[model samples]
Each structure stands twice: as C-alpha cells, then as structure tokens.
Target chain A: MQLAVLILEDERPVREALARDLGHFGGHVRIEVAEDVPDAWAVIDELDRDGDRLALVLADHRLPGTSGVDFLVLLLDDPRTVHTRKVLVTGQADQQDTIRAVNDAGLDRYIPKPWNPDELRSVVRDQLTDHVIEHRLDPLPHLQALDAARVMPLLRTRGDR
Target chain B: MPTDVHHPRSTLPRPTHLQLAGLVVGLIAFLVPLLVDIPGLEPAGQRMLAIFLLAIVLWVTEAVPLVATAMLVILLEVLMISDQALVALPEDVLAASDYFAALADPVIVLFLGGFLIADGAAKFDLDRNLAAVMLRPFAGNARRSVLGLMLITAMLSMFVSNTATTATMFAVVIPILAVLPAGPARTGLALAIPVAANVGGIGTPVGSPPNAIALGALEARGEGVSFLGWMLLAVPLMVVVLLFAWWLLTRRYIAPDTPMALDLSSSFDRSPAAIVFYVVAGATVLLWLTEPLHGISSSTVGFVPVVALLATQVMGGDDIKALQWPVLWLVAGGIALGAGIGATGLDTWLLGLVAWEALPLTLLVLLLVAVGLGLSTVISNSATANLLVPLSLSLATGLPIDATAIGVIVALACALAMALPISTPPNAVAYATGEVDTRAMATNGLLVGGFGAVLLATVLPRVWDRLGLL
Candidate 1:
C-alpha cells in the first residue's frame, strides 16, 4: 500500500502545475490530481479501492460551488480523510474561511498563491512526515519523501527484531 | 479529536508461497518423529523432536511472526512434553512452569535493564548529544571522522540495540552526507554505521538478542558468563573486526582529502530528572563493569536500575509498558526450546546422528561458526541462536571443549552475518537511506563478515584459551 497526495483545484493549469512540482515524489508516493471537489472524492474512492492511504490533500481555497474550506470541514466528518493532513494553497481565502480551515478542518499548512517550489516541497515533506509520525507508520518505504532525521526515533523503537 | 470512525482496519495478509510450503512441511516434520518409532529415542524425545522440527520450519519461513513462533514453542513444550503433557510420559517430567520460566530467565531480566537504559538514553537525547561530544576529537579528516563514527556507533550499540544505533548515527550523519559530494564517500559513510553496529553487538551480553540467548542457554547448563566475562570473551574480536571494517570501507570508498567534518555541538539534558537518570545510569554501568568487584550477577545489577528509575520517578509506568516485550518474549521462546531439548534427551538423540568426534575439534568449531554465520545471513540472528545454541551446547557435551566457548562462538557468528540488507535490522536501516545500494552493501558486508568469520573460527578460540576466558 502507498501513501497518496491529492491535489484538488478548479483550474486545469493550477492542477497540472501542482502535480508537476510534486513530480519528484511521484514514484515514492501516489500523486492524484482532481479538477474539483467531485473529482477529488472520486480520487479518494479510487485510492481506498486500491489500498492507498490519503495521507495529505493540497486544495485551493477557491473552488466553483463548494469552497475548499467547506470540503476541508467535510473531511473532518469523513473517516477516510479525518487523519489526512490538510493544506490550503490559494491567496483568495478570506480571514473567516482561513479561520474555519484552521479551527474546523485542522489545516496543516497554507501555501500563499505565489509560493517557492522549494518551500512548497518542504511544506509537503513536513506535513507528510507529521502524518506518518502521528499515526506511527513505518517510515522505511517512504523514507525518501520524509525528513530522514526526524523519523530516526520511530526507527529506534523497532529494536533488532 | 476526531475518533477514527472509519479507521482502515488492515486487510488480512495473504500468505506467500513460502509460508504455505512451511505450514505443510512443518506439519509433516512435526508428525514424522511422533508417528515413526526410532530405535534409541524415548517418547519424550520423539515429542521434542516434533516441536523442534516445527520450530525450525516456522522460524525459517516465518510462516508466523518470529515472536509467535517463539510463543508457540513454549506452549507446545508445556502441552506436549512437560509433566502436564496430554499423553503421560513414564520418564521424569519437568513442571510446565519450568517452560514458562524462560520468559523471566535472568538473562531476559538483564536485557530488560539494557533496553530500558538504552530507551532512557534516547528518551533524554543523551545518545545523540554524546555522539556529538565524543565525535569532537575526530571531527576534521574524513577517515578519522568515519573512525570516530564507527567507534561511537559500536560503543552505543554495545548498550543500545544495533538497529537503534544505526538509526541514531544516521540521523547525525544524514546532514553530513548532504554536504559531501555524493559518491563513494557517501556510500562509505552510509556503510559505516551498520557494520559498526552489527560487529559491536558482540561486545556485550545485552548488546543483542543472540548474546542473551547464548548466555541464557549456557546458564541453563550451569555455565554462566558474567557481564564483564562476556566482554572479555567477545570485545577483542569486536574491536579487531571493527577496525578491519573501517580500513576496508575507507580504502574502498572514502578519499583522505574528502571534505567531511562532523558537527560537534551538544547540549546535554540537565534537568533534575535528567541528573537523577545520569547517576542511576552511571551507577548501573559501573556496577555492570565492576561485577567482578561487587560479585552481583549481571541480571540483578540489571534489575536495580529498573527499580531505582521507577522509584525516583525518572521513568514511569508508561516506560515499562513501552519496553520491547516482543524481543524479550522471543528470547524466552528460545530459552524454553533449549530447556525442553536438553531436558527430554532430544539433543543427545540428535547429536548421535553425527559422528562429531571423528571430525577434528577446530574443523568442528569452524563448521559451527560457518553454519551460524550463513544461516543468520538470511534469517533473524536471534532465531539462528535460538536453534543453534542448544544443539551446539549439547554437541560440546560429548567433545573435550569448553561449552561456553562453543555457545559464545555461535552467538558471535550469528552477529557477524551482516552480508545482505535482510541480514539484520541495522542493515535494513542503512539500506533504506538510498546511499548504499545492494552492490555496495553486499561487497562491504561480505568482506567484513568474511574477515570476522575467519578470525572467529580460527583465531578467537585460541585467543580465548590463552586469555583463560573460557
């Protein structure tokens, strides 16, 4: 089973760009892209069917009908996505929406509209690392995508068995 | 806190072909001895042979978890051959509690202390800080830094589990790897930690499970090695093998002019609890080393810290709960297996199959080491010891050799089998870093393990005799 990252954005170009930026983690992690909330849910369904974990969701705050904040809050109620780390990657989120993302959705990180590729990758890495550690996942299979130093303590608990 | 309303319960694992084969073969192996009458063996011996055969197959194929197989051995011993056996044995039978006692065997208690202290060391960040401080003197040159890293790793591995030591050292080395030009130097640095950790595991009884298994088996036979006594027997081989590995890895991969320097900053924990832990940990080590002076058995010395740490509230119930019980239980299973084999006359029956005396003693020793090293190269080291230690101790009975030497050699040989990624957990950790590939690991592992094996087989036995350590 693989840890998967889902990119949910309304714009095709934005979805492509996010997928491209995360291309390095493609083989190590399953990267799925969806144009909107419906597509995102479809991707989650497929992931669950394939025995993949929805480890993180990178979503744009602006969507067509249901806002990203709404989806994030919805995720809190969905058992499958409750533990998934949530990130909002848009400059358009108002203070109220951002606050809900934090208070209700448990947003892990916010990537401003104009974000550095390096910082974006680092945020994703940090969030993924947190998800793995908090859930006590075996870090070896996903070591390349993780902050290697941060996961050493988890490895220590395995002992020599 | 969102309760995992839909927490994905894992799907039942599909058994592999090997596991299926193991189940079928194990049943056959277990039954053959019980059903077919042998001329010389007793009923209890036949029953034990069945359990032993089943254990060998299960451990090899890992049809079940290693610890599960271990627990199975204990249960089978109790039900099939103990005084509480379903079918009564006319021969003398040990009580079922005797089999259960393997779980709390003194050596297991000794490991309980070692693991707690090791966990405590990591809990307080003492291991990483100590690495930083101890690494200061060997900071600049590439080779010197590797040497320092290996020595410190081995020293830590002497107390900590080899896997944990490799992980801790890699945490320290990963940053340095990013700075250094990625090449043989990166490979060399990655390779160093595991080699040191595996070799270093032989340094003490509590260093690894195989040592505890060996010590436990030997103790059961009325031959116990003290904590210091084990060091005297194994440390010299450990130091020699580690130095040889350092030289091999450095010459093969690291250039002397390589720009490698270690960060040497350490802020040690100085809280009241930390201070109390420091003294308690210190006193425990002092007591362990000075076992000759204090005359306390290592297991009792081992347990003092367990009581002291809890009493002072430096460590608590949670810490006890988190201790590596699976490892402790696996060791218990091996002890039970050993006890059952020795008690039921299974060892004698099995040993009689070979004319072992016809083979020269040195050749016999070399063969034992080779089998232990080879078997553990692909299986769990503790499991290898669990099966081999009992048989070898029994083998030593008919021969004119120190039984302690045979048991210790087999245990050390198992530790020396680090030739593949699957060889040991430490090797697996190093392999996960992506710096050391299979080719690099196998070449380096073979060279170091081969060298260690040769010394262990040929030289170490004579050295032990000369030192009067046997």
Candidate 2:
C-alpha cells in the first residue's frame, strides 16, 4: 500500500514550498497539500478509499475555523489514522497551543517557520522510518524514502523468515 | 479494509460545543413559535421571529460556517413560511424565490465592487504607493509620524477590510518600530495602525462590513445614503476619533523628539493594466460620489470595477476565488433577516411594544447608540451592526427623527467599539504582534472608545439636521 504525507497549511506559498521540498519522495509516497482542516480530511478520505495508509501529517497550527491542534486531536480518535505521525509546522503557535499539541495530540515534532529545507526533509525521513518500523510494514518496498540503516535489521529478519 | 476506511461516522469529526449550542438554539427557536402565544402577533411573524433568533444565535456563536448559516436562514425562512404550513399567512407575503433575490442585493454588489477595487490595488501595489506618498509629510517628526501612520492606515481601511489594512500597515511600521528603543513608543506605534484602521473603517460605505450593513438596512427601507453623504458625515467623525486615539496613544507611550527619516519612494507599477485599474477606480469613486447627478445607484456603479478588473486582467481567477465570500454571505444574511423582519410584520409588532414616541428624540438616539457601543465591545462589530441597525430603523419609524440618522449613528457606534481584541479585527491584529499587551490595549481602547461615543452622540444630531437628513 502507498503511504500518504499530508501538508495542512493555509498559506498558498508555504503549502507549495513544503510540497516542493518533499517532492523527492513523490514517486513512492503520496504527497498531498490541504489549505485547511476540512480539506485535510477530504485528502484523508481519498487516500483511504484508494487503500493508502496515512503515515504522516504536517499541519499549521492556525486555520480558518478549526485549528491544526484540534484536527490532530480528532485524528487520535479515528481508528484508521490513530498511528499517523503528526508534526506541527507553524510560526505562530502560542505556548498554550504548543503545549496542547505536545500533550494531547502526541505531536512528534515542531518545525518553526524559516526552517532549513534539509532539516525538513530529514525530519520527514526520520518520521517515515519510525512509522515503517512501528507498523511492521515491509521496508524494502519503501526503502528509498526510509532510513536505510534503521530498517535494514527488519529487512534482514524478514529475509530470514 | 473498505469497510474500515469508509466508516462514515468515524470519518466525520465529532460535534464541538459551538455546534451543539447552535443546534440547541435552532431547536429552541423553531419550537418557541409553536409553544408560545403572543397577543397581536401573527403566526407568520412568529415564524420569522424564530428564524431571526436562530440566525442571530448562530452568527454570534459562530457555530456553523457563516455562509452556511446564511444559507440556513434562507432555507428555514422558505420552509417555515411555506403556504402549506399552519402558519402560512398569504401567497404574496413572501415568494419562495425572493429569498434567493437577497443574494443579489445592490448593497452586496456594492461591497463586491469594493473588494475588487481593494484586490486590484493590492495586485499592483497601488495601496502601498499611496500609503508611502501620504506618509512622506510626517516622516521626520515623532508625534506626526504616529499621525501619519494612523492616517494612512485609516484611509486604506476605508476601502479594504480593516484586518488587511492593519496587516499591510504593520509591515510598513515594523522597521520603524525596530529602530526605536523597546518601550511604550514602539508599543504606541504598533497600536496606532490598528486603532486608525478601526476608526477609519467608518468613513465610507465600503469602509467596513458594519457600514455596508447599515447601508443595506437603509436601502431595504427605501431610504439610502449616498456614498458622498456617508463620507460627509463619517469622514469628519473619523478624523475626530483618530485624533483622540492618536493623542491617547502618544501620551501613554510618549516617543522621543528624534526626527527619523523614512524612504517614501514607491516601486509602484506603471503598467497598462495598473493604469487601467487606476482609471476605473477613479471613475467608480466619482460615480459613487456624484450618484445624484449621474442617476446611477452606487450598486450599479459597483459593476464597473468588477468588469474592468476582469477585462484588464488586473485581478485573476485565483484572486477572485480568494475574495472574502463569507463576509458577503454574512452581509446577505443580515439583509435577508431584515427583509424577513419587515415581511412578517415583526418590525412593526416589536416597535408597537416599545413606546418610542413618548421618549425624546435625543434620549432615544443616545440609548440606541449606547446599546450599540456596549454590544459591539463584546461581540463582533459586524454582528452587532447586523442585529442593531435594522432594529434601530424599525424603532425610528413614525418618530420625529429620520431612521437613516439613527442607523448611521449605530453603525458608527459599532465601529467605535474597540476596547477589547474581540471587539474588532484590527484590534486583534494589533494584539497578535506581541508588542501590545491586553491591559494596555483595553485601557487605551476604552478611553478612545468612550470619548468617541460621546463625540458621535453630540455631533451626529446637529450635523444630520444641517445635512437635511433629519
């Protein structure tokens, strides 16, 4: 099954930049962009219908009506996306909101604005590696997008079996 | 796997408290008319009252998307007032299609035109250039610098959303603020932009949503204020309030007398498309102002910029798509509510319950203005105006005062409410900068807002008579 990475950012420029920065993984992973929470859910619905696993979500904290933290909390309740890795990419999340994201949403990482592209890609790679290992998915098929060293032991074990 | 992925119930997010509140309010509103009996109230009026109540609650709580709430208002009105329903009064009372007609209201179109103009200006950097040019004169002096920034912000807000105006002007003032020492002076500079944007939004019909709502309410009553007439009253009032706000800010955050030079040169585009936009914008404003001479309503004039901008390619499909359609929907909903109020005889019935005729005109105006100011300080200015303007109009009917005057005063009062971040978008934008704290904002906002209320109550009555409106 294909793995999906969702980018939820309201600003068009930021959303496009994030999508472009992660374009190298587009061949193996579904890279999608949503401008708000509702659009993000629509993306999830489409990916689910296509039998794709939603592995990661990079969401902005501020949105039109519902906030990104609020969306992340909702994801925890959905059985299908309970294990999805959640990251908040925001410039303006307040202390209270960031704390809520960390405590309630199990946010895996926080990437502040003006982020280095290399660091962003590395975070995405690391998060995907964790998802692959934790879910016990076949690492060989998505090895290029995952950290090779971390998943090599799993690949070897599967090979021996 | 398909069943797991397609669990419709789990796929949808759970209802929020806001949503639950909206549902409860809607249920209560719908059931009230059926259960409660009021003397001299017709069944249709009762139903309209229910719809109005539901719309107001949804708007205030923001339980649903504002546009969806607007659509609900139309839907409920149509369904509840159906000819086959028990409360049906007459076939001509409200045609099913008239609800849709509210979407095409001239005032809505007027705001559409205003949005297009703002979009076109931003597309070509026209607003920035104009701001720079306007700020050139007061660049060197510290106190005048505050005035200049406030003046420019307020002027821009008259044509665009106050939030957009504040955001844009905030960028311009950031460098200036950074150069200053970290103190009240910097804080004052930050606060002035939003304060000006809030106050300046009262200057024109297109200045703010409340003004547009006021105009829509007036137009519904067959009494309208021309674009120039609004400017004639509101511009002067804004200037007075702006001066008061500037004084309050400067006194608290007293800046040094150092003359700071600023580069006012603009990189404004001189392309053919931009030139076309300028010409179209000028002509549109002219037509709006000289509407009496041209015999074309401002709403009709609104079509010019919309067509010209599209034809000139000044604003593209993406920009059009990004326009604040929700605000338009909100305005339309308010207008629809007003129409519903008028049709159901709710306006007349509610007015009858109040002995407005017995009260002195001045006392009545002050009471209305005071109520508007109080509510707006707590709720959104647009929602406040939406609730108050129509009621003010209905109350003023058959009184010695002109409904337009009261409507205009209420609109201004709504604009004047800036004591809290929740009161207006501009104030919220200023508060977000991390430079101005809530206490500072509330203290200064209350001072300015209180002074403004008194000034408006005193000034509007005298001026309305001189302007032949009263």
Candidate 3:
C-alpha cells in the first residue's frame, strides 16, 4: 500500500516549500498537499479509495476558516486516519490551542515557524519509522524515508519470521 | 521506533469561554423581548429589537461563523416577523421571500462588480502595472517610496477590497523592504500599505463594505448620494487623511537618511487581458462619474464591468466562484437589519430615547463621529457602519442637521477607525507580516485616526455647505 504524507497549509508558498523540502521521500510515498480542512478530507478520501494509508499530517494551526487544531481533532474520529502522525508546524497557535491539539489530537510533534530543515526531515523520518513499526508494516521498501537504525531491528525480526 | 502515542477520539466539540458567553448573551437577547415590554415599542418592533441585539452580540463575540449569524438573521426574520406575529413587519407588509431579498440589493451588486473588477485586475496583473505606473514619479526617494506605496495602496483600495489591495502591495513592497536595513524604515514600509488602504477606502461608495452599507441605507431612505457627489465629498478627505497617514508613518518609523531604490517597472503586466480590463474599468468609472448626464444609477452602472469582464473572458468561472461570499452575506445581513429597523419603527423609538434637541448639531456630529470611530476600532468596520448609519439617520430626523451629511460623516469615520489590527482586514494583513506588531500598528493608527476625525469634523461641514447638503 502507498503511504501518504499530507501537508495542510493554507498559504501556497509555505505549502509548496514544505512539499519541495520533502521531495526525497516522494519516490516511495505519496506527498499530498491541501490548502484547508475540506481539501485535506478530499485527499484522505482519495487515499482511502486507493487503499493507501495516511502516515503523517503536517498542518498549520491558523487556516482560513477551520483551524489546524480543529482538523487534527477531526482526524481522531476517522478510522482511516486515526493513526496518522500529527504535527503542528506554525508559530501562530497559542498555548491553549497547542494544549488542545496535544490533549485531543494526540499530536506527535510541534515545529515552530522558521524551522531547521534538518529537524523537519528528522521529524518526518522518525514519524514514518514509528508508523511503519507500530502497524507491523514491512519497512524495507520504504527504508529511504525511515530512521534506518530504529527500523533495522524490525526488518531483521520480520525477516526471520 | 514504535512510540506508543495513544490517539483518543473526542467527538464532543469543546466550547470556549467566549463562545459560551456569546451563547448566554444571545439567549438573553432572544428571550428579553418576549418576556418584558420595552417602552414606546410595538410588539413587532420589540421582536425586531431582540433579533438585532442578538445579532450584534453574536457578531461581536463571533459566537458562530459570521455567515451563519447572517443566515440566522434571515431565518429569524422569516419566523418571527411573519404576518401572524407582526412583530417587526405589518401584516401583508412583505412576502416571506422579501425578508431575505436584501441579499440581492443593488448595492450588493455594486460590491460584486467591485470584486469582479478586482479579481480581473489581479488575474491579469493589471493592479501591479497600475501601481508601477503610479509610483514612477515617487521613485528614488526614501520618504517618497513610503508615500508612493501608501498612495498606490490607498488608490487601489478605493476601487477594490482593502485586504486585496494590501496583499497586492505587500507582495510588491516585500523585496524593497528586504533590501533596506532591518530597522524602523522597514517597519514603516510594512505599516504604510494597510494604513493607506484603510484611509483610501473612504474615497468611494464601493471602496469598502461600510461605504456600501451607508449608501444602501441612504438609498433606502430615498436620499441617495450620487457616485460623483460621494467622490467629491470623500475623495478630498481620503487624500488629506492619506497624506497625514503617510507623514505620521514615515516620521515615526522611517529614518530620513534611509536609502531607497524601488524598481516597480519590471512588475508591470502588459497583456491583452490587462488591456481589456483597463478599458472596461476606465469606461465604467467614467460612466459612474457622469451618471447625471446618463441618468443611470451608480449601482446599475456597476453591471457594466461585471458584464464587460466576463464577456472579454478576463475573469473566468473560477474567479466568480472565488468571490468573497461571506462578505456579501455580511453586507446583506446589515441591509436586512436596517430594513427590519425601518419597518418595525424601532428607528423612531430609538430616536425618541436619544435627546437630539438637548445637544448642539456640531457637538452631536462630533459625538456621533467619535462613537462610530470608537466602535469600529473594536468590531468590524462594516458592523460599525451597519449599527451606526441607520441610527444616525433616525437620530437626524429629530434634529435640524441633515441626515445625508451625518450618514456620510459616520461612514467616513467608520473607515478611519484603524486603532488596532482587528479594526480592519488591511490592518490584520499588515500585522501578519511580522514586520510590524500590534503595538506599532495601534500607535500609528491612533495618531492617524485622531487626525482623520479632526480633519473630518473641520472640513466636512464646509464641504456639505458648498454642496448645499447642510
């Protein structure tokens, strides 16, 4: 099954830059971009129709109408995307919003604006690795996108099985 | 690798303190009219008052989506103001559908035309070309660049959405700001666009929603201001305020010795679509200005650009689809509320409560202008105009002062209330750039707003007298 990494940012420049920065994993994963919550749901529906998994979601908290936290809270209810790794990649979300995101959405990470590219890549890699391992999916095919050191044991153990 | 992050489903939507407070206020507003008898108010007027109070509170608190509140206003009008209740409207006064007909008011059509023109301009890069041409004279000077940016932004906002004008100018000025040293000049450059945009929108009826609301209110009262008449009064005020804003922004933030090299010529788009837009937009403006000769109302004239742009294929279906519907709904809601107030005779009752004869006309004008400016700084300017224009007109009926003049002054003052980021979309857009914060915006806005109010009070009366409106 194809793995999807969704970038939900309303701003086109920020969305394009985020997608471009994660281009290395595009070969093995579906790198989808959505401008808002409704667009994100359409992408999720398309992935579900194709029997693909939404492995991660990097969202901005301040969107046009429905906020990123509200969308994250929504994902918890969907059976298809309940396990998706959620990250808040914005500088605008206040403490209350961040707390709600963590408490309600099971947020995996918080990356403030003007982020380090290395840190962003590492976060994506680690999240993907965790998703693969938790679901007991074979990590060998998507090794390029994962933390190899952490997934190596899983691959080795599954190889013997 | 397997970080066990437990994802729990919370189906219950959490209501914040503000939302809960809004609900409480909304409930009280809805129930009060039914429970208690307001003095000098008919049953229908009392019911209309309840809906008005509820809508105002809900709009201010943002209890729900703004469009939702607008829809609710229409729904409540149908339910409570029906022929049976006769709470706001007399029996057989209006058909059920007539209550919602405010959505299709001619003034709303004017705004739709404005949006289409703006969208077509943006789609064809016509705005950039126009800005570049306009700024050419002011190039090479640091202070003039600030003035030029403000001038271009303000002028564009006079015919387009203030937010769109600010966004377009923000993109154009960013590169210029980047080249400047990281200091007050950069902040000044960032802050000037929004300030000018806010001031500039006072130039015409279609410049902002508040202007349209004022125009719509005036038209409903059978005392409409002509397109040329409005421009004659407002454009000069806009120019004066814009110049003051430019001075205030530059003197406070920009250094005199700051070097500048603005190259806007390269940003111009000389495409066929742009050419078509220019011809159509120019013709529409000319027609609007010479309305007395043509005998066509300005709102009727607005349809020309809408048809011309579509016929020329300058604006596509997607552009039409992307029109700011919520803003239109918001304006429609204001119009509907104004109609409801008029029908219910709530305007008369409210006027009776205010002692217009007790205060001098000049003091009353200043007080009304101050109230409009103050309320707008805290809420949406459109909302401020919606709340104030109708009341000011009603209040004018009791006094010797002219209602049309009061409407004009109140509308202009609404546009001038830029004391905070939440005051207007343009201010919020500038604040989002991070180059200028709320503190910087408020400081500059207070000074500009103060100057604008004084200028209006001193100059508007003379202009009104000249136009034979006083």
Q: What is the TM-score of each candidate against the true structure?
A: 0.97, 0.73, 0.74
Tens-place lDDT per residue, model 2, A99-129, is 9999988999999997899999999999999
Count backbone clashes in candidate 2. 0
Residue pairs clashing, model 1: none
Could you give the TM-score of chain B for each candidate, in order?
Answer: 0.98, 0.93, 0.93
Model 3 bad stretches (over 4 Å): A1-161, B1-15, B84-92, B267-271, B467-470
- Of all native A–B interface contacts, model 1 reproduces a fraction of 0.72
Cα lDDT of model 1 by residue, A105-144, tens digit: 8898999988788999999999999999999999988888
DockQ per candidate: 0.70, 0.03, 0.03
What does the lDDT read for residue A5 in candidate 1? 97
Query: Once all C-alphas are superposed, what RMSD does model 3 give against the true structure?
Result: 14.1
Residue range A98-130, candidate 3, lDDT tens digits:
999999889999999988888898899889989
Itemize residue pairs with steric clashes in candidate 2: none
The model with the greatest DockQ is: 1
Give one digit per residue, the lDDT tens place, for model 2 in B1-470: 12354242334445689778877987797678757997888888888888878877876776776668877887777777644344566545777677667788899899889988887776787887899999998877888888888888998988877877776686577667657777788778878987898898899999888888889989888898889888887888899889989888887786658445555888878888888889999899889889879789888899888988888787779877867787787777778777778888888988898788988877887888788888888776777787788788988777877788888999999988888877776676566555688898888888888898887887767976887754
Which CAPRI quality tier does the interface of model 2 achieve? incorrect
lDDT, candidate 1, at B38 = 82
